[model samples]
Target: MIEEQGIIIALDGEFAEVRTQRRSACGGCVANGACGTSLIERLFGRRVTQLRALNEVRAGVGERVLVGISEAGLLSAALAVYLVPILGLVLGALVGTWMNGLLLNRSLDGSMADLPSVIGGLIGFLLALLWLRGYSAGSSKRPEHQVVILQRLH
Candidate 1:
């Protein structure tokens, strides 16, 4: 099971709204200094993403809780969130390359003047980012907690 720690923000009957912290894998990225993601995350601080879960534990507002989902669920969720954008990027690049080949009436050299290629790449990357945001927002369902809560710290 994949476990995440969060704080309960609201309780709506049998459902609890928990806000989870967003983490990036860029902590050890070699391009951390040049990566826009690292810069943005630092500027914005930790992202508080809300998720709805079963209120079986009777958690209340401001209570810290741990949510867990099955390993299979986590893998599937990640694939959906990540695969589409990658497909879009590859498709866009291919289209751009094809269009360039036809427009110039000749094959493009391995030159840096391919504006379409650059634009397509950017568009593909942005599309993926946008899709990820929506995917994350909608993927949160009634997650099952695998670990039993022995006691509340506070």
Candidate 2:
């Protein structure tokens, strides 16, 4: 399981929004003076990321608590998040390459080598963007008071 400490920002029935504290590795690093990370941190300060989770316990806003998700669940979620776009990209690339090869009058060596990659890359990028947008849109449609609880961490 992956665990982290977060402060509850909002409680919507069984779901809670928590913000995790951002940590800086630059302050204790030996290359603090030369690292771009340190420079960015100095310019922007620390950043915090907030995520929503299904609350199994009776946690309230402003309460500090430990949150955890199982490794299997995390992996599955990550795969769903990444695989859709990647698959779209691959499909786009293949289709683009095939179309380019068929439409261009040039020889196989010339057309296949040149236009296919460019068209494929463009199609892949656009498809990936669309997939990401759709995925994000679905996240907001989660039901109120319904949460998936994997486990609680101390």
Candidate 3:
């Protein structure tokens, strides 16, 4: 489980809206100074992330608490968000490439297959985004899918 400290900002029935500050983990990395991520970090700095957490601790507004989320859940979310689109992109490109060969062979003219490939990739990316939207909306209703407040903090 990945854990962080947050302050409860609001409550809704069984959940608490905890505001956690987004701190860059890249600062401690050896490649920080050499990467474009450093430039992005410089531009974005720290931001607050408000998340709904399972309020097992019954933490109230203005109370600090420790929140934890499953690492496996995070990893799966990463895989779905990143890999699915890439897989779609590759599949779409392959289909476009196949179409390019077939269409060009039949007509013996244009190699303007690049357009099809780009269009296919864009469609795949959009589909992945739609899937992600559905998953997030559905997952919000499941307690196990959300961050959990482990304990009240000082």
Candidate 4:
């Protein structure tokens, strides 16, 4: 499980909104003085992210707590969001290129070598986005996707 510590700022039924600072790698790295990350961090200090976590600890406002989500759930979500689109794009482009060759009986050196690929890529990206939207809507109701408050801080 990936755990984070935050302070509860608001409560709504079974959920609590916790505010936590988003940390960057520059803070603990030796390249802090020469890295571009340090420059970016200076421009945008430490931004806080507000997350809604399931209130399993029955915590109240202004209270610190630890919340976590499962690693398997995180990995699956990441794959769905990142890999699906790329795979779709590659497969669609291949299909388009193959179709072009099969139809024209010519190599991809033609004048419209890229049109089919472009159209196929766009269609694949759109389809992947639509599938992602539906998947997220269905997964939101699953407990594995939620970060639940596990411990209340002093």
Candidate 5:
């Protein structure tokens, strides 16, 4: 399990809204100065993240607590969130190029295909987002995807 310490700010039945500050894990890395994330962090400074965690430890509002989620769950969620849309975009562009060739009988200009490609890419991206909406809704109900309060810190 991956864990972080946070303070519960609100309670809603069995869940607690925990607020955690973003910390730089790359602080010790030698390449920190060359990393895009490090640059962004330096530019924007740190930000806070609010998450809903299962109050299995019965932690109350204003209490410090340890929240956790399974590493496998986090990996899978990250993969889906990043990969699906990109795959859709590439596949859509390929299909659009094929359609352009088919419709224009392999026109010499080739530039005509650009419009179709853009339109196809947009459509594909929108479709992927729609699919993700449903996927997230279903996954939200699974215990593995949920963040849980591991223990009260103080």
Candidate 6:
């Protein structure tokens, strides 16, 4: 499980809204000066993340708590969020190129020969986004995807 300390800012029934400051692993890394993430952090600064967690401990507002989510759950969510769209884009571009080869005998110079590729890529990306929206809606209700309050902190 991945755990973090946060303060409960509000409560709603069995859930609590916890606010935690985003921490960077790059903070102590030697490559921090050259890393893109570190540069973005330097530009925008550290951000505070607000998340609704299962208040199984019945923690109240103003209380500090340890929140956790399973590592498997986090990994699956990341894979779904990143990999699916990239696959769609690659597949769509390949399909588009194939179609172009079949439909046009010769590649036209400065013409719309690549139009199919652009259109196909856009279609695939939109389809992936639509699927993700549905997946997120269903996953949001799953216990595995939920972050839970493990214990109240002193």
Clashes of 2: 0
Q: lDDT for each of the candidates? A: 0.71, 0.70, 0.82, 0.86, 0.87, 0.88
Candidate that scores best on TM-score: 5
Cα lDDT tens digits, model 2, 29-120, are 99976989988888998888787877877777887877766666566557757787677667777877777667875435744575676668
lDDT (10s digit) by residue, model 5, range 1-154? 9998899999999999999987887789999779998998999998999999999999888999999999988887888899989988877877777787898877436566488787778878888888888989888788889999999885
Tell me how far the alpha carbon of residue 35 in candidate 6 is from the true structure, in angstroms, after superposition. 5.8
Clashes of each: 0, 0, 0, 0, 0, 0
List TM-score per model, in order: 0.55, 0.61, 0.81, 0.83, 0.88, 0.86
Cα-lDDT of candidate 5: 0.87
Candidate 5: clashing pairs of residues: none
Q: List residue ranges in candidate 5 displaced over 4 A.
A: 30-37, 108-110
Residues 60-147, model 1: lDDT tens digits = 8898887766887677677866787788787777777777778886765667557677677678777888878886666654242222
Q: TM-score ranking from best to worst? A: 5, 6, 4, 3, 2, 1
**C-alpha lDDT of residue 65 in model 3:** 94
What is the per-residue lDDT of model 6 for residues 1-154, given as tens digits with 9 covering 90 to 100? 9998999999999999999987888979999779898888899998999999999999999999999998888888899899989877777877777777787855546778677787778778878888888988898888889999999999
Cα RMSD (Å) per model? 7.0, 5.3, 2.9, 2.3, 2.2, 2.4
How do the residues 1-154 of candidate 4 rate in per-residue lDDT, one tens digit apiece?
Answer: 9888899999999999999887777767888858888898898898998988999889999999988889988888999999999988887887777877788787666676798777788788888889999988887778888879999988
TM accuracy, model 3: 0.81
Cα error of candidate 2 at position 69, Å: 1.7
Error of 6 at 107 (Å): 5.5
lDDT of 2 at 67: 70
